[model samples]
Target chain A: MLSTKEIKQSIRSISSIKQITRAMEMVAASRLKKVESRVLASRAYTERMQQVLSHLASSIPSERSHPLFTQKESVPVIKIVLITADKGLCGAYNNNIIQTTAKFIKENTGNTIKLIHIGKKGNLYFSKGGYTIEKYYPENVEKFGYNQVKTLASQLIDGYEAGEFGQLHIFFTKFKTTMQYSPTSIRLLPIEKDAIKTKVIAKGEYIFEPSAEQIIEHLFPKYIETQIYQCILESLTSEYAARRVAMIAATENAGEMIDELTRSYNKARQETITKELLEVISGAEALIKG
Target chain B: MAKTFKIEVITPEKVVYDDTVQSITAEGTEGSFGVLADHASMIAELQTGILTISDVNNKTVRFALDGGFVEILANNVIVLTDTCTKEGEVDVEKAMAEKASAEKALLKVGSGVEKEKAKAALKRANTLLKLANK
Candidate 1:
């Protein structure tokens, strides 16, 4: 049984913790709203880009191949771009992505695996584990813009062209809903042949300005850039959603603890008062008898 | 009333414009071109320049576009760009400041990708200023 003073102290501490978590929950909710809009807007752009690229891919003769579509039989190394959150208070968000990457690396034991980390948490975990970190962008995840994504896309394209790695995979959390996000990995380089193949063939012959080859050549890099940008936006949205949920849970737990502590504190105070009253009454009776 | 076609100007951030327009004139990498309703299906690479759009009411709306691509099919025109700012949306002083900074950067950077980027930035700034002043 805790003394009333101890219980009271605990209730005060817990109530303060509840206030902090409540503040965190509200902050996460507002950030989530802002990021959600960005994610939805970018989604429209990505969908249009995919539609155009697929149309081009299907229309172009098979013999006309782009360097980006070249798939190697086997290569010595594989690169993984792992995206995680910068901060850790977000439930299992970072852990899930890290685990997914680890599983991928484990499964690809025959090839040398290197990592490119986008967020600090991934970088910190992988760097300490003796993995070869190809690159790490230390920029804050919340501030990510098109420029940063462009630089990253160009680097990845250059490395792929230079044959630095046979295959490039990106691991990110796909935002399905506010309550659900799952870590997903997709092969980014040497884009799979079937991925861009469209079911609907061209209804008629189309004119290509500056040549079809030039247009396809220009569109492929933009395709990669848009894909990467969409992934980053989705991951950021998921991060905020996860943080909000985690903070809400923390706040609720704190509330429960305060409630329990207050109950115990009241019980302890009542017990002490009853004991003191009994002592006083018994002493008075003894005096009366004497 | 002029026959109109649907035109959508989209950037990565959002859809800037989506409405039925009488016609549109855009700068293609090959050269400037105009499209009316029932234009042939075509795909053209775009350059940094002013995009002139005439809506159903024959009202002209201009946008300063950073480099991207334009696709036309049937009666629909899709203009995709990295950034698109309407004439009314362009900030003249900011465009001037950007132009000055881009010129400085163009002078400082040697021959390579950096120079190309600075040149593009300068071109975009110039286009924005051109549209705004017009």
Candidate 2:
């Protein structure tokens, strides 16, 4: 028979684990709140930027003048920038992106595709799967800032302008709601036609300051950078939300385990007491008979 | 009639200024331009300079902008900037320090991307300092 001491030890270990998971859940919840506020605040800037870009794209004549607007004739090479979290234990947060990238590579068998990894998880997964990693962002994902995104944007712009890659795509988790995030792929290069459509206001006749061409030369690059920055912000918010949900689930599971262990521990103690009482009664009965 | 139009100055951080205004003067990439109520629709690239607005109360509010763009509609003008600070909100000593450091970096770096970045930083710092002093 198992001793009561062993049962007590199991109960103690389970309770300690429950405490740790509860603490982690609280931490994730607080971080999620901060990121959610930031995402909400940045939405205004992104919406205004989109409006301005669409206005320029629709109003201006000769849209093919800017290099960003023009597309190459045939697709030669493709670049995919995959974003994942550095840390694990966030449920399927990193797994979803990794699997999506794997599927993408599997489908595009003949294309010359190069991978650009933003977080360590994606890099570790793809590198093992025998994919060519063009670059891996060295900085920790938690410490991301606008300045880092700007530098990366500049590099991408330079490469796109130089015709290094015929097509560029970015894979990230789009934050739909606090409880839901979906993995999405968006084309980043050559500026998609529908993305510049303005739904807010009617098209109006406008004057360009230097010229439409000159203004576009400046606006297009900024527009690209803003899009990248927004995606990063959204991904960060989603990561926290995912982590919070995962931790909550883990904490609940730990609670259930602790409950089960406590019940078993109590049952073992009761059985031990009953056996000792019977033995004492028998011993007294034998002495009286003698 | 108050004879006012709406203007919203937004950055990545937040909406710095949003109000009905009488008039506004902004430094465009080509030159300085002023907008009044019912001005013709236009899109202009902004430089690192001051954006002066005359509010509905005829009180002039000035903002220092760090190189963005201005969009003018019939009744609304929206300014999209990387960094926008109110004249009163700026700290001159801090801006002066940033300017000095940027200038030093520019001089130290012979020629590269860092030099260009430092030059741009110096320009933005100077704009902030000027707006604060004014």
Candidate 3:
């Protein structure tokens, strides 16, 4: 059993920890609100873009393919873009994404793998594991804007055009709800026709400005850029959500610890007082008898 | 009141414009074109230029659009672009600086891809300058 002094010390430390965790929870909640709104606003643009792409895909003949949509079977190297949070207080958020990416790499042993890390945590883990890291955009996850997405998209497209890799895939956490997020992998390159194709075929025949091919050529890059932007936004939102939940749990645990410690402290103090009282009564009885 | 159709100018960050307008005139890749109410459903690739919109009251609003696509379906016109700035929102000093830097980059870049990118930047800067001056 701990003495009252030791128990009191633990209680003080735990209450301070609770204070910090409570503050963190509030911060995460506010940040989550901002990111959630951003994610919702960007959904409209991505949905509209998907609709236009599907319309264009249906109009163009299957035989005619754009450079972005061309599959290169000869190249054996696979490029994986892994997105994770820079900071790691969030429970299992970064670990889950890194594990998913590692599993992907392990499953595809036949082909050589190259990684492009979007966050510091992923880059650090992969680099320590002796994997080949082609690019590392550390700290960009926190402050990614349209220009950053554009530059990243252009780099990926240029690398693909140069035959640096056969296929390009991105791994990110999809934000389903504040309480739920899952690691999702999307094949970005070679423009999966079936994935973008909509069930509701566009109503009427449409006119293209220069040609269907030319419009698709322009639209494909924009499509890729938009997809990357949307994924980053979703991942950011999920990170905030995860952090909020983790902090809330931490705060609750701290509260429980503080309560238990306070009880033990009181019990130890009461035991000491009872023992002193018994000694005092015995001393009085001994004196009286003497 | 004139017959108006819905137009929404959207970027990745947010929806820039969403309202019913009488007509919209924008610069397509090929040439400048105007779309009135009940126009045919068409998709046009836009270049960096001024986008003019006329309201029901005949008041015109101009925006500098930096390269995007415009889709017309039913009575809805969707302008999906990288960036859109209204006439008064264009910053003159920033546009001038961008124009100068883009010109410098265009002169320095030798590869085809770099040249194309620099050209696009120059065009965007020019459009913004024009809008700001107007």
Candidate 4:
């Protein structure tokens, strides 16, 4: 029952909203393309790395010397790198990560904990609350490459090697599909012996060129770096997918509103025209009677 | 001739190369070594240098290896490392800058082990640059 003026104004506002959403959707789509390609390209590297590591673990009879491969105690202190988007309007993307991470952290509070925060949103919320954030990286997740990730990876690996932490955790929203994203926390460090897929190529007759200790000591940090890079890729892909979906939904909703408003505006316009027409006819009829 | 095997060069970001190569020439910790079709089981302590692989066409594909290890066994060679770039992909200016910075760090820090690491980094960057640009 809205007046024509009111209906027109509503339609104008809805159209503006739709325009903004459509713009946002285009931007998200561009970012999604890059991150998704990176993930796809790196999957081959990940598989081959797994193959090499499995081969080494099975061939070598002794334990790994690097701190990352060692699992100590019944309960190990875990360091978690939580990646969340900076802005809002992504629809439960941040909420999902925060909830899952909070639960995990609270339960593991009895053990030592450290957090690596990637986005401003998570840093602000966790810092405001009582969570102790060990490090915060404010870099643009969209432009991530191997060099930056290696630096961070080296820092963590160095810390672990220095006996700073026992375990590593990574939390992020996983991009399942365009319509679905699930916040997941995964163990990132300490390539467990049982978890290895590739078996050692040479068992007893293997010869370590310079020395066994030196070769393993070198490959450990690289392994850490590769793992972290994969996580960053996943998190970025999830962000884009989430944002794109959110924008699309908004645009569709705006379209529905526009349809409703157009109908209302038409009804109001017809009523106004009919009223004016009837008034003229009545006035003419009155004039004739007079 | 022996059957061809896969040689995959994997870095942290992505796979640099994955093709069936005839041989691998890499700088091992002890010395530079080449792996043919029937190589012995060897774990190489990788230093920073140029890694060259001979394709089936006998053409050489060179990759600048930063610091990591190379494992040659069963003819399946895996070069795992922190940084890797092909000859066509290397940035010479950047590598020179890295070498200079590492040298500067070495000069400032006199700690024996760290200085050695810095020295190694400089050598790696310089050698990779030389091999890549050549």
Best model number under TM-score: 2
User: Which runs in model 3 stand beyond 4 Å of their true positions?
Assistant: A73-76, A106-110, A124-132, A143-148, A195-205, B1-6, B19-22, B37-41, B54-61, B73-76, B87-134
| Regions of candidate 2 where Cα sits further than 4 Å from its true position | A103-110, A195-205, B2-4, B98-126
The true-versus-predicted C-alpha distance at residue A57 of model 2, in Å, is: 2.8
Ordered from best to worst TM-score, the candidate numbers read 2, 1, 3, 4
TM-scores for all predictions = 0.87, 0.87, 0.82, 0.81
Which parts of model 4 have CA positions greater than 4 angstroms off? Answer: A54-66, A74-76, A106-113, A124-130, A138-151, A162-164, A175-182, A195-205, B12-14, B38-42, B57-59, B81-134
Candidate 1 regions off by >4 Å? Answer: A124-132, A143-145, A192-199, B1-5, B37-40, B96-122
Model 1, position A283: C-alpha lDDT score: 100
Q: Candidate 2 residues A165-278, lDDT tens each?
A: 878888888887979999888777866667543443355568889788888888877887777778777788888889889888888888888788778878888998999999
The CA lDDT at A179 in model 2 is: 95
lDDT of 3 by residue, A201-267 (tens): 3556668897878898789778888898888988999999999999999999999998888888888
lDDT of 4 by residue, A74-105 (tens): 44578899888878777788888988988998
Ranking of models by lDDT: 3, 1, 2, 4
Q: Encode model 1's per-residue lDDT on A133-185: one tens digit a residue.
A: 98888988877778888888888888888888899888999998999999998
The number of clashing residue pairs in model 3 is 0
Interface RMSD computed for candidate 1 is what? 1.4
By DockQ thresholds, what CAPRI class is model 4?
A: acceptable
**Candidate 4 chain A: minimum summed lDDT over ten consecutive residues — where?**
A195-204
What is the full ranking by DockQ, best candidate first? Answer: 2, 1, 3, 4
Fnat of the models, one by one?
0.63, 0.82, 0.60, 0.65
